[model samples]
Target: MSQIVAAIDLRVVQLEKQGVTGMALANQMMGHMADLQMIYNTASDRDLRKLCQRFPGFGRYAMLMEEVSEQNQTMAMSGTHPYGDLPDLPEPLKTALVHVLRAAADLERDFQATADDGRGDNQGRLTTARWRWADDLEKLIYQFQSAELPLQTQALVQQIIKATAERIGRMG
Candidate 1:
């Protein structure tokens, strides 16, 4: 997974070389990514449910749900943001993002398992683990989003963001 994150980071480097600085592409990616982090930080199932109301397409955000369902606990919480494009990120960054997603997925699993264990003992550790993973992901996302790529690349990123926002904005 770390390798994947490294690969994605490299891709960002490559994109920078190709010219993708100052564009909203990085920012847009960060926004959706931040939403994922927020969801993982959610403290209650009810909150998760409320969050889901905005993007009914949550089932598509499978990075973390698989493990949760396996534990037989339903999400009572909701989160903002839907799954959008994650294309073009380098392997390391991409892998890191995926790992973040996986961690979220694993968190759901832990949440459910704790419920079943009924010991209430795992809650503290699970919560700590989830937060730890989320924090790291947040740092990486911030690093990528704030990165200053080449000037031409920046313009291209802005163009892509404008086009994408326009497209998705219509649906919203």
Candidate 2:
């Protein structure tokens, strides 16, 4: 399983270096979805959490790839109506979401930049941003867990939180 994951990770890096993007990159990644899922499902919780800490950006990369693939499928199926409207989020939740999103964007931006190009220490910046993102996500999860949300929303949040907490735990 580790070898399979390593091969996929190497392939992704190679594709990125070759300038693959959008549907092409997502399509390539989609081929490894089953293997990735198997690894996630079969790995022990402690091992998975360690893996996440060791490769901080990998979870986000896999999620983005899967999302891109799903969006492409949706667009192909719906042609013009590719997405639906988002629900009206509660105020506190909305604010939390915004903060989390901004932190995630900052993390991604830092991840893309050179770690040390003589101007600044972007590796430290990236680490800070990653922790901020993780903290914000945990706060958001706590808010959802404590709020008087709709049953479906609460259930979905609980499901996601449970899976994530069990598999990868908290980064901070």
Candidate 3:
């Protein structure tokens, strides 16, 4: 198990060093992400210490991922960010992603930029971002539904959507 994890760590590092980007990096990480999510889901609290021991950066890495996921949910509920996490996602979902991002950017430039008071303070910001979030959900659902995802992956994606939407709805 140690050797296997060491190999995975080495491979990911090597890939990072190779400067993979955009759709390519997304495609590669999809497998690892799926597997990691599966293991993470199944891990008992008692198993956590062993997992951290097995993966040198597991704790910090997982925390950061959770933080990012939370931030994404916050953005969906609150407002459009000036910058996107990634301007693009990998196909076969890129088409939908690009369209939604463009729409959000257009809103930011046209309405958010011109607001006398800061747009962030206004409900318009939340409205615009939610528009994009709606697009985000639609596209992602299509992507997930169409993909040959494992059961664990499908469940995880569903959980993410359901949780984020539920939280955002509660804020309204």
TM-scores of the models, in the given order?
A: 0.35, 0.40, 0.35
List of clashing residue pairs for candidate 3: none
Local accuracy of candidate 2 as per-residue lDDT tens digits, 37-86: 67778988788766656654355456666686677678767765323332
Worst 10 residues of 1 by lDDT: 77-86
Ranking by lDDT: 2, 3, 1
* CA displacement after TM-score superposition, residue 85 of candidate 3 (Å): 16
lDDT tens string, model 1, 128-172? Answer: 785686576656556557765454544554554344334333322
> Alpha carbon lDDT of residue 31, candidate 3?
28
lDDT of 3 by residue, 140-172 (tens): 788868877566656755654565455445433
Model 1, residue 17: displacement in angstroms? Answer: 47
Candidate 3 RMSD computed on C-alpha atoms after optimal superposition onto the true structure: 17.7
lDDT of each: 0.45, 0.57, 0.51
lDDT comparing candidate 2 with the true structure: 0.57
TM-score, candidate 2, is 0.40
How large is the C-alpha RMSD of every model relative to the true structure? Answer: 18.5, 15.2, 17.7
